[model samples]
Target chain A: MNEWLLIFFMAAVTYLPRYLPFALAGKIRLPQTLERALDYVPIAVLTAIIAQASMIRQGELDFSLTNYHALAALAAFLVAIIWRNLLLTIVVGLVCFTALRLLV
Target chain B: MRSPLFMMGRCFPETYLMNYRTRQFWLGALETLPLILAAFPFGIVFGALANSNGLTFAITAGMSSMVFAGASQFIAITLLANGTALPVIVLTVFIINLRQMLYSANLMHHVAHWPRFVRAVLAFWLTDETFATVSDRINRHPEEPGLRWFYLGSALFMYSFWLFSTILGYTLGSQIPGLSDWGLDVAMIVALVGIVTPALKLRADWACAAVAFISSLLTFDWPQQSGLLFSSILAICVGMLLSRSGKTNE
Candidate 1:
C-alpha cells in the first residue's frame, strides 16, 4: 500500500507538468521569453543529464581516462558531430565503453 | 475478444491498409525503434535494481505503469532504497519531470486543434523518447495531418517496450549480479547526445550546452540532484538571454 501510494504521488507529480501545458497552452499564447526558454530545454536538460551520468562516479567527479563513461561520451560526442547519426553514435559509444572497461 | 490486427481492421474498415494515419503511426514507431532498443537494457536495470533495493515486484511494475518516466523511476528506486521521505522523493521526481513541461509547451502549437481532453491523454503518454522522435517529424512537416497517430504510435511502442524490459530485468537480473553497475545507462546518454548534438546548430544552443555541462559538473554533489535542476535553469536562462540579444538573433 505504501508503495502504491508512492507510485500514485509520482504519477501525479509527473503528470501535472506534462498535463498542465497541454491543458493550458493551446488556448493562449505564452510570452516570448518562455518560448525561448522552452527552445533551450533540449540542450540544457540533456547536457546536464549527460554531465552527471558520464562524469560523476561513486559520488565524485571523474575526469580520468579510467572513467569509461566520460571517455565513451567523448567518442560518442565526436561521432555525433561528424556523422550526426544517433544509431551510429550509440553503437560507437557502447563499443568504446565496453572495450575500455575490458581492456583498461 | 479478438487479436489487435482484427481490432485495427475493425477500427479502419474502409481503408485498413491504405490509411495515412496507419502509415504515419508505423513510421513514427519505426523512427523510435533505435532509441527504444538502446533503452531496453536499462529497463531491466530498473527492475533488477528495484528488486535488489528491496522493492516488491508490484511496486516496481506499478511505478513503470503509473509514473512511466525513466530517469525519475530510477531515482525513485534509489531514494526508496535509502529510505528517503515520500514527499522528498516525490518532489525530486517532480523537479526532474519539469522538463516535460518544456516538451509539451514546445509541441503545443502543433496540436492546438486537438481537444483539451485528448491532449491530456497525449500528455499522459508524452515522454523523452516519444517527444524526441515525433518532434523531428512535426518540425519538418508542421502542416502534416494525422501526426497525433504518429505520436501515439511512438508513445505506445516505447511504453510497452519499457514495461516488458522492466519485468524481464527483474526476473533475469537476480541471476546476474552487478548488472546495474555494468553501465548500461550509458546507452541512454549516448542516445540523448545523438539527439541533442544535431539540434545544437545555433550559437545560443551551443552556449546552453556548455553552461549546462560545466555548471552540472560543478554542482554534481549537491543533495538529491538539485544541481541538475539549477544547471538546466541557469543554462536555459543564459541561452535565452543570448538569443534575445539583437546581435545573436540568428
Candidate 2:
C-alpha cells in the first residue's frame, strides 16, 4: 500500500469514533450502564498501552532482567506516585532508563 | 429527545453570564502547560523514532497533524517498520484510539448543546491531555459558560506544541545523530503515568488497570498487536462487571 494512502486511512479510522459520539451527543442519551462502562475506558486503555510498550517486544513477552523498558517503567511509576508531577516523573524515568541501559 | 436546555442538569446551573472566554482560555492553556511540556520529549522522541523507522519527513509529520495521537502513531510506525500490512496497521491504530470514544462521551453532556462544527473541531482536538485538563476544569466549574473556549485553549496548545516539536525533532534527528537511541520514548510512558495515577481514586479504576496490565502481559504475543485490543476489551468488561455487581462506585 502507498504510504500516503495508509496514513489517510489511519487518520479516517482514528477520527470516526472520536467524532461520532460527540456528533450524536445531544441526539441520544446513553444508558446508565453504558455510561458507567465508558468511565473505565481511560484507565483500561492507558494501562494496556503501557503494558504493551514496557513488557512486549517484537511480538513476544520479555519480562526478563534485560527488559530495560519494564524496569524503567517501574521506576517511572514509582516516581509518578512519589512526586505526583508529570515532568519530574519523565525526567526521572529518562535518566533512570538511560542509566539502566548503560548498566544492562 | 427532550431539549437538554430544559433539563435540570447535574452540572451546576449558569449562575453568572460573565463574558470571560479569553480569561478561561488562557487559564485552561496555562493549567495544561505542564502536560504540554511533559508531552514535548515524547513528541521529539516520536519524530526521531519515526524517521529512524524509514518514514519520510512528510509522512512522519503528517501523521502528527492528521492522526494527532501519540501512542497510536508510535504503534503505527513500529508496525510499518515491521512490514505489517496496511489494513492491520489501520485497524490497530483505530483500536488503540478507541479510548477517545470515552473522552467524547464524557464531554458529550457538557458540550451537547454546541453547534455541529464546533463539536467537530473540539472532538478532533480531544486527547488524553486535553481530556484530563478539560475534564478537571468542567468538574470544578460545571456552570462556567466559557468551558468550551477553555477546552479549545488547552487542546490547541498541546496540538501546536506536538506539531512543532515533531518537526523540530525530525529536522534535527539526522544532523544530530543518535537522537533516536537516547531512550527518550520512556518519557511518554512517564507522562502517561502522571496523567493516569490521579484517576485511580476508585476501586473499579484500579481493578480495570490491573486487569489490563496482566492481560497485556499474557496476550502480548498476539499477531499484529491485536493483544492490545483484547486486553482493553477484557479490562473494560472487568470494570463493567465490577460496576454492575455494585462492588465499586460507578
Candidate 3:
C-alpha cells in the first residue's frame, strides 16, 4: 500500500467504471428500467454531495444559523433558481455568506 | 479495431467533411468556458487545502492531473490528510464518482466505434463538465457533427486550467489565504446550480429536488457522511415511485 501503488490502484478502479460503459455501449442493450434509473443518477449524486458538503459539520449535524454553510447553500440554490446563471448564483451566495459571517 | 488516428477522425468527422460545421465547435467551446472559469477558484482552493492539510506540492499537482476529477479528488485528499482510513477515503471517492459511470454509458453511444487507444485517452478526460458541453451540443445538432474537436477543445481547456490553478494554489498556500474562507467553494456550487436548474423543467424533477433537499435536512446527523448518501437514496426512491405511479395512473 505504498503511495504510488495506492494512487494507481485507485485510478484504475475509478477509470474502469467510466471507461467500460462506453467501450461496450452499443454491443449491449440497456433495459428500459435501467435507462430510467440512469436519469435519476445525476440528481441523486448531486444531492449527496451537496448534503455532505453543506449539512455535516465536524462529524456532527448543525441545523442552526451557526451552520452558515447550509444557509449559504440554500440561498445560493434560491438565487440559482431565480437567475439561472452560474456566476451570479455563486457570487451572491458567497457574498451573503461572507457578510453573514462577519456581522454575526 | 480502428487505429487511434482513424478513431480520432470518427470522433471528429465534421472536421474531415467537406462542409465542416464550425458553429458546433464554437458553441461547444463557449458553453464550456463558463464552467472552466468557475472551476478555477475551486482548483485553487483544493490545492491550497491540500497544502494546508500537509500534502506536498507534488502530491497536490499529481492528484489534480492524475485523477482529473474535481470533487472526488478534493474529498479524497481532504479526508486522507485528516487521517481518515485509506479504505474509507477510497470508497468515499469511488461513490462520489459513481455518476461518471452514467456519463460513460451515455457517451458510449457516440464513441463506441472508437479504437481502444482512443477510448482510453478520451475516458481519462471525460468529466462532468466535458459531458455537459458535448452532450448538449450533440443533442442540439445531432447530424451536424464534429464531435471530436468539440470534446478535445472543451476537455483540453478544462484540463489545462485545473492543472494551472492547482499548481498556483500549491505554490501560494497560506500566502494567498482566505479565498476558501471567502466562500469560493460557492463558485463550484454555483456551477452545479447552473447545470441542475436548467434541467429542473419537469414536475418529477421538481419533486426529486424537493425530496433531495428535505431528506438532506432530515438525515443530516448521520455519521461518516452517510446521511448524504441516505438522502440521495431517499430522493431517488421518491422520484422513481412518483414516476411509476404517474405512469400507472395514465
Candidate 4:
C-alpha cells in the first residue's frame, strides 16, 4: 500500500514539472530570473549525479587514484569531448572500466 | 534520385514542404535511435536492481511507465533498498525531476501553438533524450512545419523502447541469480557522462558543472543522498549569479 502510494506521488511530482508548463503555455510567462535559474538546472543536476556516482566509494568520498569509476568517467568525458560521439564514448568507457577493474 | 523538395529538406528551410511532416517524424526517430540503444542496458539494469531491491516486477515496470525518468527511478529504487521512508523517497525523486521544468520551459515557445491534447501528450512523453532530440531540432529549424510530429516520434520511440526493455530486464533478473550484482550499472554512468560532457561547451555550463561536482563531493556524507540535491541547488544558484554578473554566456 505504501509503495503504491509512493509511486503515485512520484508520478504526480514528475508529471507536473513536465505537463504544467505545456498545459499553461500561453496563459503564463515565467519570470526572467526564474527562467535563468531554470536554465542551469539540467547541467547542475547531471553534474551532481555524475560526481556522486563516480567519486563516492561505499558511502564515503574516495578521491584517490584507485576510484575506477572516477577514472573511467574522466576518460569517457575526454572521449566525449574529443569525438563528440555517444557510441564511441560508451564503448571506450565500458572497455576502460572493465580493464581498470581487472588491473587495479 | 531524390526530388529537389526532398533535398531542400536537408537544409534549414523555414517551412517544411507539405508532405515533409511524415518525413521529419521518421527523421526524428532515426536521429534518436542511437540514444535509445544506449539506454537499453540501463533499463535492464534498473529492472534487475529493482528486483533485488524488493520491488515486485509489476511495481518496477509500473514505475518505469509512470515515473518515466531513468535517473530518478534509480535513485528511488536505491532509497527503497535502503529502507528509507516513503516520504523521503518521494521528495528526493521529485527534486531530482525538477530539472524537467527547465526542459519544459525551453520547449514552451515551440510547442505553444500545439493543441491542449498534443501538449499534454508531449509533456507526458518528455525525457532527457526526447528533450535533447526535440530541442536540437527546434533550435536548428524553428519554423519546420511538422515539428510536433517529430517530437512525438522521438518520444514514442524512446518510451516504448524503455518500457519493453524494463520488462525484459525484470524477466532476466528473476531467472538469473545475482544479476544486479554484476556491476552492469556502470553503463548508466557512462551514458550520463556522454549526455553531460557535450553540454559543457559554454563557460556558464562549465561553471555549473564544476560547482555541482565539488559540492556533491563535499556533501557526500549527507543522509539519504540528499547531498546530490544540495549540490544541484547550490550549483544552480552559482550559475545564476555568474549569469547575472555577465561573466559567462554563449
Candidate 5:
C-alpha cells in the first residue's frame, strides 16, 4: 500500500477500537466475564511490549549473564515491585543497562 | 436512557459555576503538565528512530499527528522502515492496538450521549493517558456537569504536547548529538513501570503480573515477538482463574 493510504488505514483501524465501545455501550451490556477480562488488558499489553522490547536480542532469546538489558530490566522489575516507585525503578534500570553496555 | 442534551446539561449544571471552573483549570493543568514532560523524550526518541530508519520527517511527524498512538505507531515505523513485509507491519500494529477495543467498550457507555461530532473529536484523544485520567474522574464524579469539557481540556492538552514534542524531535533528530545514544529507548519501559506499578495493588493483580513476567521470560525467544502474546494470555487466564475461584468461595 502507498504510505499515505497505509497511514490512513492504520489510523482508521486504531480509532475504531477506541471509539466503538463508547458508541455502543448502553445498547448492550458487557458480560461479567468479559469485564473481568478487560481488567487484565493493560498489564497484558504492557507485559508484551516490555518483553519484546527488553528481553529478546537480535531475534533470539538471550537470558544469560551477558544480556545487560535483561539484567537491568530484571533489577528494575524487582525495584518496582519492592519500592513501588516508577521513576526510581526506570532510572536505576536504564542506568544499569547503559553502564553495562558501556563496560561490556 | 437520558437524552444527549439532558445528559450534557446535567453534567454541566448551572448552579456549580465556580466549582466547575476551578476544577476544569486544575484538571487541565494537572493533566497537561505531567504528560508534556513525559511525552518529550518519547517524541524525541520516536523522531530520531524514524529518521534513522529512513522515514521522511514529514511522514514521521504525520504519523505522530495522525496515528497519535505511541506504541503501535512506533512498531509500525520501526518494522516498516526495516523493510519488514507490509503484512507483518500491519499485523503488528493491529495487535499492539488491540487493547483499544476494551478501552472503547468501557468508555462508550459514559460518552454515549454526546453528539457525533463531539464523539469524533474525543475519539482522536482516546489515548491511554487521556482514558486513564478521564475515566478516573468520571468514576469519582459521575454526575458532575461539564464532564465532557473537562475531558476535552485534558485531551487537547496532551494532543498539543505530543504534537509539539514530535516536531521538536523530528527537527533535531540528526542535528542533536547523542540524543539517540542517551539510552532513551528505555523510556517506554520506564513509562510502563510508572503506569503499571500503581495497579499492582491487589493480590490477584500481583499474581497476574508475576505470572506474566515469568512466562514472558521463559518464552522470550518466540518468533515475531509472539512471546509477549503468549505471556499476556497466560497472565490473564491465571488472573481470571484466581478471581473466579475467590468468588466461588464467597
Candidate 6:
C-alpha cells in the first residue's frame, strides 16, 4: 500500500505501452488486425470511464433525476456535438452539475 | 516525411535546417496552446482529488510529474479511493495507456530513422494532445523537416503547464476542506466527452462507444473494476468486428 510503490508501478506500466512500439519500429510490425483494433482503444476506454462516473451513485445504478452527474453529462454531450470544443464542454458540464446540486 | 522545405534548404543545408527546427519548435508549442487550455483544469482537479484521497501532497503532485497521463491518473486515484488492489490499478492504467502504443506505432513510421535518444524522449512526452498536434502538422505538410523539434516543443510546453496546474490544484485542495468531494471529478468525464464526441467519426467508433457505455454500467459493481477492463475489451472487439463486416453494428 506504499503510495510511492503504487506510483512506480503505475508509471512503469504507462511507459511500456508507449516505449515498446518505438523499440520495435521497423524491426517488427504488429498484426494488422491488432493495429486496427488499437484505434478503438481510446474510444472504448473513455466511454466506459464516462459511463461509470456519471451513471453510478453509491454502488447502484441511479438513472433517476436525482443523478445530477448524468444530467450534467447529457448537457456536456449536447454542447460537444454543437461546439466541438474541449474547454467549453467541461465548463458547461461543471456549471450544469453545480447548478443542479444547488437548486435541487 | 520529407517536405519541400527540406529540398529548398539544400542550398545551405545547415543554416536552413537550424532555422527550420527552431521555427517548427515554436510552431508546435503555439498550436498546442488551445488544447492545454482545455486540459489544464483537469490537471488541477486531479491534484485536488489525489490529495483528498489520502495521498500526501508530495505524492499527489509527484503522480502528475511522474505518470503524466491524465485519464489514467484519474482512474488510479479513483481506484485508490476504493482501496482497489495495486496490481489491478496497474493493469487498468496499462490498458488505458495501450492507446499510446497506436500513437507510437503510427508516429514511429516517420521518426524511426531518428536518433534513439530523440525517439525515447519523445516517447516519454507522448500524450493525446501532442500526438494530435504532430498528426495535424504531418498531414498538412508531410515533408516538413525538423518534426522532432516540433514534437519536443509541444511536449515540453504541455509538461510545464500541466505540472504547474497540478501544483495549483494541490494548494487549492489543501485550503478547501471538501473540494475533492464536490464532484469535481466530473470534469475529467466531461473533458473526455469533449475528446471522444468529436472523434466519433466512423460507424465502428460509435459502436465501440455505445457498447462500452452500456456494458460498463451493467458491470459497475464488479470486483476491483474488472468491469472496466472487461467492457473495454468487449467494446473494442465489437468495434473491430463491425468495421470488418457490412458495417453491421453501424
Candidate closest to the true structure, highest TM-score = 1
Q: Docking category for candidate 1?
A: medium
Give the RMSD in angstroms, all C-alphas superposed, for model 3: 6.7
lDDT of each residue in A32-60, candidate 2, tens digit only: 87777776777887788788877776557
- Give the candidates in order of TM-score, highest first: 1, 4, 2, 3, 5, 6
**TM-score against native, each model:** 0.91, 0.81, 0.79, 0.82, 0.77, 0.75
Q: Could you arrange the candidates by DockQ from highest to lowest?
A: 1, 4, 2, 6, 3, 5
Query: Which pairs clash inside model 2?
Result: none
Candidate 3 chain B worst ten-residue window by lDDT:
B18-27
Q: DockQ numbers for every candidate?
A: 0.76, 0.55, 0.42, 0.63, 0.41, 0.53
lDDT of 1 by residue, B5-114 (tens): 45556776754666788877876777788789888998999989998988888888889989999989998988888899999999999988888888888887778888
With candidate 4 superimposed using the best TM-score fit, by how many Å does residue B153's alpha carbon deviate from the native?
2.1
Docking quality class, candidate 5: acceptable
| Candidate 4 local Cα displacement, residue B109, angstroms | 3.1
Task: Give the docking tier of candidate 4.
Answer: medium
| Best candidate (score: DockQ) | 1
Candidate 6 residue lDDT tens string, A1-104: 48899999988988888887887776776688887776676678779878998899887999999988899999999999898776678889889988999988
DockQ of 2: 0.55
Which docking class does model 2 fall in?
medium
TM score of chain A per candidate: 0.95, 0.87, 0.92, 0.82, 0.87, 0.81
- Error of model 6, residue B128, in angstroms: 4.7
TM-score of predicted model 5?
0.77
**Which tens-of-lDDT digit does each residue in B69-188 have in candidate 2?**
987888888888999889989988887777787678877788888999999888888888898788766655778787888888898899999999999888777778788666565666
- For candidate 4, what TM-score does chain B get against the true chain B? 0.77
The regions of model 6 sitting more than 4 angstroms off are A1-7, B1-42, B49-57, B71-111, B128-150, B247-250
Binned by DockQ into CAPRI classes (incorrect, acceptable, medium, high), candidate 3 is acceptable
lDDT of 4 at A16: 92
Off by over 4 Å in 5: A62-104, B1-22, B25-36, B84-88, B113-115, B132-150, B177-181, B218-227, B248-250
Q: Largest lDDT belongs to which candidate?
A: 1
Task: Rank candidates, lDDT, best first.
Answer: 1, 6, 4, 2, 3, 5
Per residue, candidate 3 scores C-alpha lDDT tens digits across A34-67 of 6665566566656656665676676666787887
**Model 4 chain B poorest ten-residue lDDT run:** B1-10
**Candidate 4 lDDT for residue A25:** 81
